[model samples]
Target: MLIGKIENWTKERNYAHPVIRRAIDFLDETDFSLLEDGKYPIWGDDMYARIMTIDAKPRAEQSAEKHERFLDIHYLLNGEETIGWQSLACGAEPVRPYEEEQDYALYGALSEESLQAMKPGMYMVLLPDDIHRPGLSETGASVIRKVVVKVDKELL
Candidate 1:
C-alpha cells in the first residue's frame, strides 16, 4: 500500500517489484497539474486491470481477477473513493484464464472484507494477491482526482 509521505515512496519501492518500483518512481515525478481541472486517465493495459480515473461515485460491481498478480497504484487527487478488496483465502476461487485477457482471471464469487478510503494526494497499492473492488462512494460523488499506472507482472 502507498501510505506515508512521498519522500518514502522510493524507499518503499526497493522492496516492491522492479516494474512496480519503476512505475511508482515515474508517477511520483510526474506533475499532476492537469488533474487540477478534473480527473484523467494516465495509462492502462488491457492485459491487466483497466487503469483509469474514477470520479467520485459509488463503488461498482467488479469481477476480481485471479492467479496472475496485479499492481494497483491508486492516486487520489481530488475527492475520495472507497476501494473494496477481498482475498482468495476468504473469497471465491479463480477460474481458468481466458484468451481475451490472459493477464486477468475470472472469479467465482466474493464478499467485501476490506475497504480503503482514498482521497486527494492519497494512494494505495494492490498486488495480484489482492482482490480489489474499487470506485465506491462513502458520502456521494465529490470532485475526486486520481491516476492509475499499469505494470506488467513479468517486470515485477
Candidate 2:
C-alpha cells in the first residue's frame, strides 16, 4: 500500500508506471465537481475511475474488502474519514464471497487492523494484497466525496 498527499506525488518520489502516473495525473487534473457519481474510463477497460459522494458509517458497520484483478487508487475530495487496513496474511474470514464480475470480496476484522484518517488531498494506492475498509467515519457517520481509480494489474 502507498499513501501520500496528491500534491506531494511529484516531489515525494518518482513514479515509473505510466498507468500509475496517469491515475495520479487524472486526480490532479480533473475537476471532480463537474463529475457525477459513476465510473469513467481513464484508459479504456484497462483503467477506470469511480466517483462517489457517500455518507460514511463507522468501522464496526463496515467490512474490509480486496480486489483480485485491480489495484485501487483512492483520493479523498471532502470530509473526514478513517480507513482500516490490514495484511491479507492475517487470516481473517471473508464475510462475503468473491464476485468475479465486480472483482470484489469482503472480509471481517483482521488480526491487526490499522486506521488511517484521510485529509482532503490524501490519496492511497491499495494493491491486491491490501485489505481495506473504506467509507467509514472517525466518530460517527459523516458525508464525504471521493474518487477511486481502478487499474488492472496487467498495466502495472
Q: Give the winner by TM-score.
A: 2
lDDT, residue 117, candidate 2: 92
Candidate 2: lDDT over CA atoms?
0.89
In terms of lDDT, the best-performing candidate is: 2
lDDT of 1 at 58: 56
Which pairs clash in the backbone of model 2?
A: none
Writing each residue's lDDT as its tens digit, candidate 1 over 112-140 gives: 55777765666677676776666667787
Off by over 4 Å in 2: none
Model 2 over residues 22-131: C-alpha lDDT tens digits?
Answer: 89989988999998999999999989999999999988788899999999998999998888898788877778988999898998867799999998999998999899
Question: Model 1 clash pairs?
Answer: 58-137, 59-135, 59-136, 59-137, 70-128, 77-145, 78-145, 79-144
